[model samples]
Target chain A: MLDLAILGLLFEQEMHGYEIRRRLRDELGLFANISFGSLYPALSRLERSGAVAVTESGGTSSAPLLSTGSLGGERAGLRARRSGATLGTKRSRKVYRITGQGRALFEQLLEGEEPAGADDARSFGLRLAFARHLAPSARLALLERRRAQLTRRLATDLVRASGDRLDVYTRSLVEHSTESTEHDIAWLDRLIDAERQKQAASRTDGARSADSTDPSDPHSGDAMTSSSPTGAS
Target chain B: MLDLAILGLLFEQEMHGYEIRRRLRDELGLFANISFGSLYPALSRLERSGAVAVTESGGTSSAPLLSTGSLGGERAGLRARRSGATLGTKRSRKVYRITGQGRALFEQLLEGEEPAGADDARSFGLRLAFARHLAPSARLALLERRRAQLTRRLATDLVRASGDRLDVYTRSLVEHSTESTEHDIAWLDRLIDAERQKQAASRTDGARSADSTDPSDPHSGDAMTSSSPTGAS
Candidate 1:
């Protein structure tokens, strides 16, 4: 499911494996960044499965194009190192693009909503990680949908957290996880709003942040901005 | 460190692998039970590394008996099946006991207290999961030590959870994880108290829960006789 999400995002833009990893980190804070433990094998698997195709490795002499995606700019340049270098040398990374089959797979993935098991910590992270691979509209729709689900859970947990009727330890556990999910849901809503704003703004001229006084500015204050991009403060 | 913890627990009693698994679940509640994904491999690795040694297989029977002075049980049964099962079930397993090397290794692991990086989720779970493997006295001591750590964390989080804080989303994430860990620490304390109570009761030639008066026993109102085990209730 996760790899499919990564592949779908890559389908939107050709990215080296490292870029895919960085995007996962930046775009989805809780999303597991692809590491050597999983990344190399997953790319190889995707190539074998025909879900992704890799371009030839980049030349050693080209100026390193740093990753500009979400995890801030500090470590982005490190993405270009050679696979075998000791230190300070650039690694050759294979650029991967989603194949036509990959898109169909992603579509299938989006169409089906797997049962979200609340018991698994990994699943919580996985769901949000894959949130971006959905069609932008579908992604917001899912966020609204998930927000509703979490709202219900938070309501129940609040009763538990505030009550003196239960064992203290058990109550705290339920309350803690509930609050965490609630935070994620609220952030998701903000993200959806931001995305919608971005879409509305795109329909006009593509300007960055709106100039409040310029009526012609697409990003004018007339349009409410969504919550900031970082899901967690 | 996790493997060392598991091995140390085994040295305390001749328990089935399932029993060791139970301790993690009921007591630690840290890592989910070692799945077939890691359990079989972990056991194999431990044996190969000579941290443990297998006794003679319960020969010729479908269920085999092996002793590591401390290690052995369901794992031996699994090992027995490993040799006889068809095709895919042929992974070899060997039961093991802590060698002198294993003991020394465990002692070294106990001396370290660094937070292993967030790189491996499994590693985090494993380390926390095996915390109970410390000597009962040592484990309880650590719990006391951790209680202080959690107290400080909970104090900080309590402020965040309170409505006076304005960073709603930020507060949510911090409070959630903090609350859960606090609950876990509290639960550990309860278990430690119960263990201490049981040990003290066992040393005395009296019924457990002997300190509390039993309401059900009409004649027990004034009597100094050992209270029924349910007296505490």
Candidate 2:
């Protein structure tokens, strides 16, 4: 989960660890609280896999800078070396940029199916937060999958509420849970409908334009937006 | 959480491990899937700590049974040996009853303050499921604590939503989450109001009767029923 979020953020801009954490907390607000304990290792793993490149970043910049090391042993002197020999503090800062390989990995992780259980809610929410990166079809699949999961939960909740002689509190909890799941399914339905409508509109535009090619394919297209449903806040 | 659920179930009736798991899933629906791996360890820990007593219940019987040992021993004359010499499976199955110490432990665990975190929802749900066992004041306190927790969450979520330039999908997720929190707070308010009314009603009843005392104090009084608020389905 942290890996997906980290990559998504880095995909936006090269960032040091502190800046990444700050953006995660203050900007995206996807993760309410993230510990450094889990963040550094994810970055290091991404680096080790050649999916990300690390630069010294001049101790101040959080952007990617080419390493001023001996590229050909002689090119080191061809251009004045950047002042990024040993940038960033030992631990709290080291600019990380997503490599071409990292973008591929990020897309794969974003589209992957999450395993079912307690982490399902967080996983789906995280995926939705990055839904703009997904193909419209994949985005629709995400919403549908969550709607199905919630619908199944509602069935079990209803069965428990009906069959069991629950006390007032437990019964109320189950009933409320069922209502919430229903609300989620309704919201997903609206999103699905909007996705279809957007697809149709783009397809018509693609057909009408003679000179312009439709970039509606997964890799080229912009994200589709959905209006809030009648079942919303 | 497992410990509290186990003790709460046993507080109602002495039960075998299998029966306990079934009830947890089917009856209370507390743990959607309570694995035996966790349940057995909890039962063993409770027994070791003198919080529970295990008896050799024949695999088929789910009722309380006397402990029997050494069928051929001379002490059979003092008391006839029960047929529990070779009862239950080797380890996975045993009848566990809450001991006097166990009951005390259960009460303490049920009434204890749960710290706010990832497990807060499950912990609060488990506590509310067993609210019948709590004193009225504690029940009210539980609802209020949850209400305060939700209120805090709502504030942070609102701030995040307001400050962040969220994508449509993520913005929707946050808005829906905020709405759910508000709904939960409304439910808690209803519960709190009902708890106060129950206490007030019992106080009136106590005042009405001069000769016969009203047994409407915390433990003796029945669980209060809260009507679902206008904020609910």
Candidate 3:
């Protein structure tokens, strides 16, 4: 999940790990802090796998002189210069950019299913956060896929609530949960309806403007705003 | 999280691992499948910690005769006879019941904070699911803590949206996500309000009816319905 978010951010701009964490927390609004422990390891793995490229360039080096005065710091800097100190001690800022391979991997991972019992709110939110990168059809598919998943979950919740064995509080909790799922489903339906309407509108606009300009592109008149529904997460 | 759910269920009834999974899925309506790999290890750990006791009892032996008369069946039968098999072919059934210590552990685990970047929809949902077991004050605290977490998240989300760096769709996604969090916080507020009203009502009732049944019990006049707002998840 973090990998998908990382690639999505890097696809926009090359960033160091700190920028990635900041963007993930601030922009994407997912993964809150995205601990450096997990972030660096994932970056290393992606770098090792050739999905992202890390270059030791283009970072402010104002404080490096004072930090590198110590003999031990000098030795560590030498080691870093040799093997590339990716962990960031004395400001060898590694700017990471997603490769063509990384873009492919990101798409693959975004299209993939999270492990069962782990995919609902966070995974869906992250995917939808990057939904603009998806093709129109793919975006529709994503919405529909989430709708189906939530529908199945609603079924299970309804079944669970039918048991009548819960106390007043637990039952209240279950009923409220059921209502929330219902609201989510209703929200998704509105999104799906909007997507379908937008797709249809774009198709009509495409047919009419086929002789003028390419209508299949995302910038057409009826693509985003014609019948935009509540496409919130 | 799973530990809290498990102990909550076991507080009601002694159950084996499979039963625990079923209850989690069907009753609590969380932890859909709870993989056996993790589940068994958790059970073993709890048993080792004396939080739960493994009693060898209470499982139907009817299914065992189905696949037994074939190769390796004789050895299985001998093993079952030796261990006095309670459920399956290869092993004795382990029914886990919460010890007194387990109840303490359950409360501790439920009250503990999940690491930042992790405590989220699932954590909040689990806590709400077990809210009935909590004291009224603790329950209100949980709801307020969640509200604060979400409120902070909403601030970050608004900041993220203001950058104007996102595409139309991504902006819509972020805006929608913000709205969703707002909805969640509002729901939590309702729950907290109801809880406060109930607590206040209980204090009043206790002052009035000094010799009656405990006014602050979970089943009192102001318990769920009196001031229950739209407290869905």
Candidate 4:
């Protein structure tokens, strides 16, 4: 899960270890307490596997430290320059950039089957966060897989509740759990409906374009807009 | 987390290892994939700590194997007896029962501050599952603590989404995550309200009972009903 989160972030931009940790907490809202102890080891493992390349910068270079446009990066760079450590023999900051191999690995992991014994909620959240990079079908599959998992959970909860000799609090907990799962399923249904409609509309546009001779039609522009990286309406 | 779950089960009734595993999966709906490899070690740890006591049974003993009244236990017992293993040198099944110290441990763990870096959702769910054992004030605190955690998460998610360069899918994921947190908080609010009402009603009953001279008034029965172990109104 940590690997997936790290690769997903690096897929967007090169980042040093500190920046990656910050984004994991602030931007991703998962792995909020990931420590440098685990983070450094994961980074080292990724480096050893050739999934990422590390480049040292910020020793004497006046260039900006981070590739990200966030002000936090600029401030960190300024602080480093002001400290006069740039003139010392200290090792430079190592920025990690995802290699082509890492990109392939990310895609593979994103599209892969979730392993057993994994934390299901975190696994799903991490994949959903990076679903934009997935093919449309793959994205739909991800949503459906999550829906199925929750559905099974609800079924089990109902079965357990039905014959339960459970105390009041446990009964309430089970009922609430069932309701939450149902709510999630309803939400996924909406997303699935939207995806199908978008896919159908795009297919109709493709057919119309093939039937017409116009090279610059408005419908083609609409198709491009709908299929843009954001995949938002 | 595993220890809490194990003790909670044993607090209800004594059970052998296999029965405990079954309940942990089928009843709790959490730790569904817990293997014997981990389960046995946890049981051993608990036994070593004097939290649980184990007794060997099923050797030439016709007594029901499990304290739980589930039909599954009957079948397992019948199968063991039918296979003639009950008469063999195969070690008798070990039935684990929670000790007084174990019950204390369970309560302490349930009411304790959640450790950092733990799986937050699982920790909350486990605590809520056993919340019937908590004092009313502790139960209210648990609900409020969970509410505060979700509120903070939602705030962070909204801030991240506001000035975000996130792709469409990630943006949608964040939005959905925010909505889910809101849904959870709303659920907690209802629980908190119910808890407060129950407390108030009991207090009113107490005041009335104190004012009355009759030791066996109808209101006393009402009070008893409300304070029953089931705690369901």
TM-score per model over all chains: 0.46, 0.73, 0.75, 0.75
Comparing only chain B with the true structure, the TM-scores of all models are: 0.45, 0.75, 0.73, 0.74
> Candidate 3's residue-wise lDDT over B1-233, tens digit each?
67777787787677789878877778777666678988889898888999998765322455543432223454455566665323344444566899998977886776676444565777777877777666566677888998898898888678667986665556766777787788788888888888888778868887453212233444322233333244332
| Location of the lowest summed lDDT over 10 successive residues in candidate 1 chain A | A215-224
Better of 2 and 4 by DockQ: 4
* Error of model 2, residue A31, in angstroms: 3.7
Candidate 1's residue-wise lDDT over B60-141, tens digit each?
4434343434454657766655676422532233435677666555544542443423333333333333433333344345
Candidate 2 lDDT over residue span B1-233, tens digit each: 78899998888777888888887877665577788899899999998999998866232356544445212233443245345432334333466889988877787787788768656888998998888777666777898999999898788767767954566777887787787788788878988888888778767778442211123323432322232223121
Per-prediction DockQ: 0.06, 0.25, 0.34, 0.29
Cα deviation at B128, candidate 4, in Å, is 1.9
List runs of model 4 lying over 4 Å from the truth: A57-92, A116-118, A207-233, B58-87, B90-92, B116-118, B207-233
For model 3 chain B, the run of ten residues with the poorest summed lDDT = B219-228
lDDT of 1 by residue, A152-226 (tens): 656655653565443322343445445556656666677667667756775585654422322332323221234
Residue pair clashes in candidate 1: A81-A90, A81-A91, A82-A90, A82-A91, A210-A219, B53-B96, B53-B97
Give the clashing residue pairs of candidate 3, or none: none
- The per-model lDDT (C-alpha) reads 0.50, 0.71, 0.70, 0.72
**Where does model 1 sit among the CAPRI classes?**
incorrect
Q: Name the regions of candidate 2 deviating beyond 4 angstroms.
A: A27-30, A44-50, A53-91, A207-233, B56-92, B207-233
Q: Candidate 4 DockQ category?
A: acceptable
**Candidate 3: segments with Cα more than 4 A from true spot:** A58-90, A113-116, A207-233, B57-91, B113-116, B207-233
Tens-digit lDDT string for candidate 4 (A130-180):
766666666677888888888887877787779656656667767777777
- Candidate 2: tens digits of C-alpha lDDT, residues A110-148: 878875665687889888877877766677788888888
Q: In model 3 chain A, which range of ten residues has the least summed lDDT?
A: A210-219
